[model samples]
Target: MAAVPLRRPLDAETVVVPVGQVFVIPERCKGCRFCIEFCPEQVLVESDRMNAKGYRYPVVADGKERACVNCGFCRLICPEFAIYTEEIR
Candidate 1:
């Protein structure tokens, strides 16, 4: 009789992300809100009005540090790619 192959179960673990931060460039930002919606932490929010180009720009609102996880979700999702992250030294 042929021996049966054994299968191993995958282990579940939480992803540990490094302490990262993001910055929004007013000049580069087109205020598309792509970062605001895409950000998992909801760190970015729409300001009172739009930018010079008539677009809603994103700004860090509420929690200053805890809010933004620096996942770079907004940066990637943004069509303009205006979102940028900075590492704390």
Candidate 2:
């Protein structure tokens, strides 16, 4: 066989991609759907039930887990201040 070059394996010093899960507060949400529309990852979903304000709030889907950047934009848009993001690690 002809001689071939081999690629080196990745080491600890290599850059690692970061991933995290998004969390939503059903009780705190006012059902404004701000997070749902504003989320860059499109992870947020509308809940079946409404919040204290009788408005449908945004919620994170259980099955469709996504890597969140934790930008905190949802928290800022939320009038109720119900949504919050945290790092997985």
Candidate 3:
């Protein structure tokens, strides 16, 4: 029989997590929920407010501080190029 060494689990709190700041261009948004629907973290939601183009844009969900992971999925899926994310310092 061969012996194997066990690896310790990584602690999530100790890790230097990357934070994201999502930007929604209201005028450019077409009221598509792709950003909100595709967000893995569920950080975004449709805002009751309307843009100049009469489209509902995405806003960060309540109580979702530092929720975005900066994965760029929203930007990629957006047909209007209205949503994007920036890394928080």
Per-residue lDDT of 1-89 in model 1, one digit per residue for the tens? 99888874454255444556777767667766777776777787887776777777787786766556566677778777677877562
lDDT of 2 by residue, 18-58 (tens): 55656666777666677888787787788788867677777
lDDT of 3 by residue, 1-89 (tens): 77787865578558676899999888998887988887999999999999988889999999886888888899899999898999994
* Candidate 2 deviant stretches above 4 angstroms: 1-15
Which has the greatest lDDT? 3
Question: Model 3 misses residue 32 by how many Å?
Answer: 1.5
Pairs with steric clashes in candidate 2: 31-56, 31-57
Estimated TM-score for each candidate: 0.64, 0.64, 0.80
Greater-lDDT candidate between 2 and 3: 3
Model 1 residue 69 lDDT? 59
Instruction: Candidate 3: give its CA RMSD in angstroms.
Output: 5.6
Tell me the spans in candidate 1 whose CA falls farther than 4 Å from its real position: 1-17
Q: How many Å off is the CA of 3 in candidate 3? A: 27
Could you arrange the candidates by lDDT from highest to lowest?
A: 3, 2, 1
